[model samples]
Target: MAEGRSEIRLSPSLRGRIERFLAAAGPALEEFPPLETQKLVSELYVHQMELHLRNEELRRKQVVVQRFLHRQEEIQSEERFRSMAQTAIDAVISTDERGRIISWNQGAQAIFGYQEDEVLDQHLAILFPERYRAACRRKVERRRFSGMVPFPGKAMELHGLRQDGGEFPLELSLSRWEAGANSGYTAIIRDISKRWALTLALEGAAHKWRTTFDAIGDGVFLLNLDYEILQCNHAMSDQVRKPFGEIIGRRCHKVVHRRSSPIDGCPFVRMKKSRRRETLILRRDDCWFKIAVDPILDDDGNLRGGVHVTTDITTMMLAQEALKETLARLKRNMDETVAVLAATAGSRDPYTAGHQHNVAQLACAIAREMGLSPEQFEGIRVIGLLHDIGKVAVPAELLSKPGKLSELEFGIIKSHSLMGYEILKRIEFPWPVALAVLQHHERLDGSGYPGRLPGAEICLEAKIIAVADVVEAMSSHRPYRSSLGIDRALEEIFQGRGVCYDPEIVDACISLFTQKGFSFGQEPFLILSPADETGAAQGGPGPGREPAAVRSEETPVQKGKSAAKKSGGLEGRQ
Candidate 1:
């Protein structure tokens, strides 16, 4: 038993020594099997070798994968750069230090109409027109002085030569860079054909506007918010007696009116604040101008300045003022003539003494209500006063009779319109005043007595006077009848609208008398023109007399007596 115990102690120490030796050698021979070891130790060594082999395989695979990923990143970066360069609208070309073409993008192909093969390795001067080649070389030399910025955002107008030898305008921006020890320039060029055309058109429009402003018979100016003269045309300069350059930057009041401050309702100031137009009479030292100011706006509709257009109305206003006296005299003479003529017609029939004068007053009112132009309205007023002047041709005995006229006498009265036309045709007035007299009896639908003119052909002025004439004739007392009320006169016109009178004029007249509460009668004659001297001398009413009678009459003795006095009035008017 003691011998067995000693053997056990020796076995344990020997096993511990064997385990230490295996641990020390395990790392160096991890893949190799230990041939001198026991079978169990050899089996452990084989398992460790298999695990080391698998780890080595996995490390090799990881290294291959990392290399592939780095290469993929480089390819993607190149692709992105290429895409950006291709999409540009301007031509981009790069050249080597020796001035030979290096990289040509698609934009370069489009601008110069040259394929990459045609331009690559060629001189950069090939893209320049012959006329600009020398200039381009000087430009290239100047680039050395400039710090190289990228070839864009710098606009320089230049000429480019296409492959077909045609030349086009271009805007170029250039950059110089170093790549792999080679110096080069990248020129970005854009064709400016469309832009140049638009520029030329804008220049032409500006020139036309300037020409119009300068050559116009009136004055024109551009003003800033402070009312300084920003621009003035030749006419304005002439008016102010100053040179254009001298006038510019000077206050408008100082240059024009010799004043240091603005006047009330200053057009320029009003235009700036309101962004609208303002018109007023501008008085300078010796000139009166109708000046209009309009605001100038930018592309975004921002107010930039004011434009002032001035029309010289001094001469016109002076002429109107000068003619005042002559007009007054003419008016007085016309009143006397109308009264005498109207009274002569009425005197034959006492009951109709104030009929024509009252009609004239009513006709003038109707003309005002119709919104007729000033000239037309004036013509109506005159013609309304003298409308029945031709009735003097009728016999007095028939006119004063307090009974209905025979058909023959009535037929004769109908000739008054034609007679009036013939009587006034020789007088040259600014208006066709005689035409209004003749047409006043005509109708819109061609249904009235006389000329039978239809719509539009019946002048607006005539339509108004016609309605007034009918109303006056019907409302006033006649020798054969009593006075018809205003309502009856209106009903007559209302019934005749669109048939005997213009609907608008009839409606306007109705509105004036019925709705507006305007009344007529007992007013003196508003004479427009004189009667013949032969008619005037026959014991007729004088100026300021009431209206004459409604008569279709004349006396042979009265015609002979008035001939001389009527001739003098005609000569004076002429």
Candidate 2:
């Protein structure tokens, strides 16, 4: 049966040939081939079994090859992950569920000054300072249980510790991942010391600028293009009589003027339009302010807004006005006093009634013609008005004598200049009015009375007065002589130029009366009293006569000339 089974499994062609042989040698083969056929069939079955075993061994080897390839691929993926972490500029670290650092990359070693081996198995809290470690552990534990991160997927600044026990600022970003059954956290950290320092420096500068802005004494307002107040200092708040919060964001005109529109010729508007500085003086509630507006510009040279500074000048303006009023009052008082003194002196002697008045008017004109300063002219005017003030002491007989006086009377009359100096020297005056009075009779050639001061020694005011005195004396009727006339007066000064009178003064006096048509406004008359008629006939002192040293029309000229002639010449009089 087994031989038959083997024959049935043969190829068709072999089976056909075998069947033919079996038919031919059927009887003969039956006896010899039965054992051979069974043996061959059994050997074929054994070879098939060996081949099946080899095939099963090859299938087992193929399974081993597949597993080896899969393991190699996993190792390459791990190598790539390590390469990326090591080369990253930021520190990379992985912590286990307990917050223990399981993996530390080379970047972590560089940033924290630690080796991978040193940080592994250590608590991740070791990267934070002791003060922050407790808080950090609590936060990590909270995240683990609640599946909530305090700063997940976000970078946060925190204090970090280095291997050398130093602390620095760092930015940290955290994330969570699952490694099989264990949950872990990955942290990316970066050193931020330079950036933090820069931020602090900028904050410091801004603080300094804010401090300076508030320190100004003048009211300062920073305004936008719309004239709205954007920022203001304490002074501005005080100026508006409001708090800083209330003043800000309000229009400047509304705050300052209390109106919806700007004031006329608004400096802020002008500054914006012109892109330049503008200034104006404003008065509000009787207070004055000097307001200055300056435009602010951007980097591109476009107008941004304006800065308004208002300075209070009310006190200064009030002080200036008060000073002007005071000066005017003082001038009025001085003029009234001068007029009274001049009238009193003129009243003492009827013969020289308007003598001082005429001298003063001519002296002022001469001074004006000479282009003397107002102060100089004023001094000359006052001196001329009071030139004969000392004549109050002279006897009226000596003052109004129609004939030449005795030597003693002339000496007494000449003392009037010295007396005038003594009376006025003690009074404080802006100019040398007293000195000019004392020196008025002094001639340029050292030829006049009281003191025969030379031209250089005499003041210009005295020189001008002396010339005016001579001209008026000669031009008017004196007690001793009839009017010498204006022509004779002018000729006398012209002849005496550089001798007794200042040459410039003589020229100025001449020019005024000749070219300028100068005149004493009103002429004065002597109202002779009944006592004066008798005293004039007797040529002696009368009831209303002043004391000895009184001035007369002849006192500064004729009497002086008479004394000079008797003593030889003007140079010899003193």
Candidate 3:
């Protein structure tokens, strides 16, 4: 205190505050300082002002450093985002509020076939199909200020235009982003061409199958294991007299049969047990239906359910019934005509009254043994019954004479075959009846009367008749000759086999007598098994049962006739 002045020191802030107070209180405070102290107060004030200016400069530089650090962080964040978008399989695009392209990722470049340099600053509408371009531009313009909201995860589908001018389907999802005074939209887009094509193909296939299902004329339905109809076609609806809507999702039995349970003899029920197709003919509502069931199996071959198909067979059954009646009537009338013809021819010769009948029966038996078809045998029988018809033209005394005929009478007998052929040729029989009658007396070795055809020229029917006529004539009573007995008759044909008669027909005739125990006057002759084509020993109707035939290959006797009918290449059954 004593040495005239006290020293003073202050921090910059303190100095500044004190200087502010000194200036604001300057009139009194200026004098309060000692004269030396007062002189330095201005210098203190000047130093304080310089320090304040330096602090203001430092604060301004700190603000600049903070801004630089923030900009670096933003740059790093944007680089990371760009990297992610570049690697994405889908297109990623960024646009300004004006919809101008600002950033295009590698994915977007690949999808759109455009480089970033080419697309940058271009309108986003360049990537949209022509139809969508104007709409997209108008949409962005309308929302230029507010921009779009943050899009949800769901994507919108549209068509995208490519650099090649081709359009492909696209799925677009976008989100809104804002940074300071800047705001824009980022969109993720996917190419959906393959997916769209697959969907269309599936729709087309479904349409084709549905069309085929409905086009079927038969009533068809898919049945589950529970017998419920999962689906039914139009024909099925028609059959049940119900709409398709009423049939689906209902029990099959309830829909078709109008029953609580399955109908009796239901093919579906039988198929469950057999696991094979089962069919049934059902008659209901005056209509005939053929119901066929096929099983649907799983991959393991286990039965799953069934497909029921109902076909209307009313017309077919009725036609079959009508045909059967027509055939029966024709058969009866023909049989009567054959019997009458035989009787009229035999009437002239009193002893040969039953001779023609005996010959016809014996010829049929031989034909049967020789593996002839029913048609061939039938032709043989008809020819045998009428073989002597020409005898009717002769005087009654000549046929009934008790002595051997003169050479002139024998010549007359030989001419009967041609006469019978001439008479029978006028009728339209289904077989070669006239030719067979004409050749019945012809011999294989060219020794017999009339045409005297060789074995090859003679039809199978005539060959059979020749052997049967000889055997029957020798065994039976005749006015011109004594009964030689059955053994002698068979021996005659057996010795002449392949000489005067067809060896096959001769052997067949012998077998009928020796093995088959066949005789004349028997009402019912044997009708062998249809499968005895190899001449297996079909059991006889009565006492006669023959062993298996000796012939190894007995070809169909009427194969030529059957073929002729098919090709129209010959006369009637020729």
Candidate 4:
């Protein structure tokens, strides 16, 4: 039995305990049977074997449990990675060394329009457009050899093909990795068709806007809150006589005014404070500009900057000033000419000495009282001075006659108005001076005139002159009569108002002498030459008197000849 049994291996401590047990039991067993001792030893060996077998089985079961736990952890970790990739917005794709698709997440499936089952094991080049397939292959080969990817770890834009054979823009980032002995690649991709289209559209709009800005005729500027120029049009560059590059980014004052600080009443400063538009006329180097500053605001209604527009108005301003100067000069010349002409006409008719001067003064006062414009008043005054110019054509004796004149003599005197019109029509006066001269003798009632013009038919200026003439002729000494007095003159016009005189003119004259306290000066008539005499005769009727008769009716034909000769002389003088 001992030969048949294998050797029992035990620990030193166990063997010590077994030997101590044998020593204590050996004397006790000496009285036992030999067969019984052997049998007991055999049972002790069997029990030791059973304990060793149980320990081995427990160790094997523990190892199996550890493996199972490790595998469960690994499965959970893989699930977490796949879930992250599937939920991501960007497409995630994995490929093996041969460039065959190994993994396609949900994002990849949506972006490529392909199912995972349909794309698995498919070549990665299938997702690339035909035009880009060769380039992709080249990059893959290069990466495998050099351990470097095309645009490694950086996003690149390229064309991608969908399952429906449609192509679109995509942004891709490629990275390489290793799993055991096999190398693979992961690509993070995103569809960028909308982004790219929007970018292109914005670029086109910006280009068009820039083109229009430069094409403007007025100077334009975009300025920040600090008044620094952010952008400027070509017109602005030209306005400042500087290049666009030099003007941009510089302070507006520095660029435009050549100053370090803002100008007084700076429109930009005002606009900034008020958050409103401002306009101003500015002059620089003899040039005038109308500048408009408009505020720029952000989406939140916050003031961001301003836009400035400047229009050149130099030509318009200069033209207006020149027109004003010309008008003033013309007025001065007209006044001087009228004075000279009145003095000349008065020199030929001394019986009505200073007649034209007094009439002109009174007419001007009437015009002022009537609230006439300066130009109208001036016309009335000039016409008053020249109203009797036709009397120069009358014979001196006929003009100075002191008795009632025959019809033939009165006819000759009435012809003077037509003669005056003929003479004056040749000159170009700004106002209707000649026409007023012709019509001054016309009456509103058609009862006292060469033309018999009545009422509104006569010009306003002519009516004013007629009123002044009547007043001055009656108040002053004349060849045909002594002074009738100002009261008699006023009475005559008041009685003849709306009959022979214009009511408006009559009222204005009355207001001037009465309410306005206007009076005529007694300055002696100006004589133009030695030939002009102070005793010269005039042709109009004196106050409240009939037409004067010639001193003699003899030699009527000779008288006509003499009157014609005198008219010619007067015409020559004019």
Please, what are the lDDT tens digits per residue for candidate 3 over residues 1-574?
A: 2232333447787677667766766678655547646556777777668766766666788789999999999999999998998899999999988889898988888888999999999998899877877777887887532222234555778889999898999888876689999988888899999999999999999999899999999999999889999889999899999998899999999998889999889999999999999999999878999999999999999988899999999999999899999888998899898778778876667555577778888888887788888888788788878877766776666665555456676566567778788888998999988888888777788865687678889888888877777777656665444554665555555556667777667766665655565668775654445343322132221133222222235322233223222323211100
Tens digit per residue, CA lDDT, model 1, 1-574:
2311211222465567567767866877554455645664765566567656766666788789898998898689868856877788788788766556887888888888899998889878788877656555555556541332233446578678899999888987777777456687877788999999999999999999888878888788888777888888998888878997789999998887678897778777778778999989966667678989999899999988888888999998788778997898886887676567667656655533455566567777776776767776666666666666656665655554455555666556667667767777886666666787677777777755576677678776677777787677656655445554565566556656666767767777665554454567533323334331121122222233322323226332232112212322110000
Overall local distance difference test of candidate 1? 0.67
Task: Assess every candidate by TM-score.
Answer: 0.48, 0.60, 0.66, 0.60
Cα RMSD, model 4: 12.7
Q: Rank the candidates by lDDT, best first.
A: 2, 4, 3, 1
Q: Note the Cα lDDT for every prediction shown.
A: 0.67, 0.76, 0.74, 0.75
Judge candidate 4 at residue 118 and give its lDDT: 96
RMSD of each: 14.8, 14.6, 13.1, 12.7
Model 2 residue 99 distance off true place after TM-score fit, in angstroms: 4.9
Q: Where does model 4 exceed 4 Å of error?
A: 1-98, 101-135, 141-155, 158-169, 173-198, 238-246, 269-306, 310-354, 368-372, 375-400, 405-463, 490-511, 515-517, 521-574
lDDT of 2 by residue, 284-397 (tens): 889999999999899999998999999999999899899999988987899898888777777877545587878888888888778889988888889888887888777766
Q: Cα miss at 510, model 3 (Å)?
A: 4.8
Clash count of each predicted structure: 12, 10, 0, 2
Number of the candidate with higher TM-score, 2 or 3: 3
Give the 10-residue window scoring lowest on summed lDDT in candidate 4: 533-542
